[model samples]
Target: MNEVAQAAAAPGLAVKRNWLAFGTGVGIEIGAADLRVSVVRLRPSGARLLGEKTIEGFRHRPAAQWGAEYNAFLRTLGAAHLAATVLLPRRELTVRTLPMAGVAEKDLASAIGFQLDSLHPYAEEDAVPAWARLKG
Candidate 1:
């Protein structure tokens, strides 16, 4: 059996991959009470299934806690893939689609910054954010 299957078979197992070599990517989303995160294996046609983990009790302030939790998730899951994209709440964006306008072209970081500012309810300027365009 491969490492992936072994890890998957074990309860509460985390899978790590060298994203640069494997072309894998990570996705994260901020939820109301908990943070939703996932790992995606990138492919020419689409992203393949790898693994996902969620961090509970995510608060707005004291951002360091989130980092620590993420590190813990990676360590517990044994995931070494460093490239990650965090998903922001769509409602945070001050965008209305009355006429079905297209999505914004700005970098994902900027958009997340805006979302964090509004969703956080507290001022935060130290977190770094990055995102990639995912094909459907």
Candidate 2:
């Protein structure tokens, strides 16, 4: 069995990986109530979770304090060298899904941009929009 399998079998053990060899990535999501960080190793087969951490008490904290704590947590995971992606709070995002029968994949982003004013709650200039086709 691989290290991932062993970690799965042992509930309390943290998943370990040589992230440098795997070119891993870290994803951080700052939600209203908690902050979550997940380290993933991308492979030909699929992405595997190397580790993850969630910290509560984010709702009322100062921004500087939260940044310090988040940095410390990443250091603990040895994730400072990894590429990171941060997801802002969902409340700040405007998300919508529309079905267009003949929209080509190449024109999707442009099409979304053209319709942003009607699809999003905020003004087109104020809102940032992202779209992906849903698989049926």
Q: What tens-digit string does per-residue lDDT give for candidate 2 at 54-101?
A: 867777888788778777777877777766799997688766678767
Local distance difference test values of all predictions, in order? 0.62, 0.75
Q: Which stretches of candidate 1 lie over 4 Å from their true place?
A: 1-22, 43-47, 76-81, 95-136
9 in model 2: Cα distance from truth in Å? 35
- Predicted structure 2, TM vs. truth: 0.46
Clashing pairs in 2: none
* Over 4 Å off, model 2: 1-21, 44-46, 95-136
Please give, for residues 46-82, the per-residue lDDT of candidate 1 as tens digits: 5776777777777754679878878777665456657
- The true-versus-predicted C-alpha distance at residue 24 of model 2, in Å, is 1.0
Clash count list over all predictions: 2, 0
